[model samples]
Target: MIKFAFCYEHDDTLSFVKNEVQNCLRQREIEISVLCCHNACELAQRAHSGCPDILFCDLEQDDATLRSAIMNVKRANNRLICVSTAASHSAHAEDILLEPLYRMPALNRKHLWRYAALAYEKILDEPASFTYYVRPSYLRVPVHEIRYFASEGRRTHIISADCRDTFYQKLDVVEDLMRHKNCRFMRIHKSYLVNASFIAGFSRDYVLLTTGERLRISKYEYYQMLTNQLKSLKNTKLRYHPSYSEW
Candidate 1:
């Protein structure tokens, strides 16, 4: 069973998103454990003990929760992926509420399908990390933990969460490695190669991230490519088969 945590500050919004997430998983016949916490740090602590897989939240209300939760998970050396009720966000009264990756774009009710896709992708038992050489030992990070890769002069920075690690490498080499693993990343600028799934939305001048940070868009081709890829996520296929009993 996959484990999911929803840390929230409001109730109605939480219910809406949770129900949608549940429906999406039910369609795929995947079993999940749902944990609700108000404070993300506590959520992370419990998640660490349980090796939790996914986190869902309302970004507007849970920024503090999300920040602390991310830190706790990081300190425990675990990965936490959040699904917010922002990809295609809509202003809703307390009466209405709802709910990942590339397809979400803003935290609107209509984007939960893409959210499910991200959740399933994270749960799949595939090779899920990127490895970079670090002298005697290498750093292996789960692909989802990576936010973006930036190349500055002679060094490259692997930025994730709130931390940045620098190493000697070229952006082209990193892009090649991502492609080799079938990881979907897009180059919005010559210096920034971003994970497509983390893309919130974009304007002609900038690409917005779920984290509320903006990166400049240089090449229109990559932006167009990313748009096409996100459109395709709507057709994302989900597969899982349970064993049959031999009597």
Candidate 2:
């Protein structure tokens, strides 16, 4: 279920944004489990009380408290996907926030759908489940919960924060599907495909995921590529681990 909250200073802009968001989700066929509409001050009062899973807000609005409040919630919850509706250059500054779904001049349907599609992929909704079959029956697992996929012999194991599932599949097949799905994953080794959000730290030979598990990097070239990728990212607004070697 995806709970969406909207915040904006202007009433017309808020309504338009809400409408666009609904349309985008409908196009993706993702149902909004909980919908909230709020102005800057109203959201500021309850931003920390219970933050939504996804937030669409005007970061460039003339409200510092609202911006700071939303940002604080984002810092506290790494799973939360916040998309900005601001079109100005200042709102897209490096220090503002790490946004994945927002595009400049995003007041239209097409851009909004792209953002919604991203949110849909990341949401813990049932429709975004990763499916596997065992004979005649099929099991579905929420894509967001999956931490990694590993192959052992001819069977593939799916690891999530909640559970582990094993099924007959190839890691290569899983990797290919995940890439086409635009999932937040990286192939650190031939046998392992890890969720990018679960990654906590990095060293030359291994990646330390947030689940307190370390996965080995198979090759020096792959390690370097991942290191470069991590350096170019601000997804977590994080600094690399102090032990991380430049090489």
lDDT of 2 by residue, 46-105 (tens): 655666778887665556666667667677765677777655655534433644445436
Off by over 4 Å in 1: 41-45, 85-103, 128-247
Best by TM-score: 2
Residue pairs in steric clash, candidate 2? none
lDDT of 1 by residue, 51-157 (tens): 45677765555354466555565445444455654433444342122111222456555577556545555444245577664444446677666788999975788
TM-score of model 2 vs. true structure: 0.48
Q: In lDDT terms, how accurate is model 2?
A: 0.67
Each candidate structure's count of clashing pairs? 11, 0
Could you tell me the TM-score of candidate 1?
Answer: 0.43
TM-scores for every candidate against the unseen true structure? 0.43, 0.48
Best by lDDT: 2
User: What RMSD does model 1 have?
Assistant: 19.1
lDDT (Cα) of model 1: 0.62
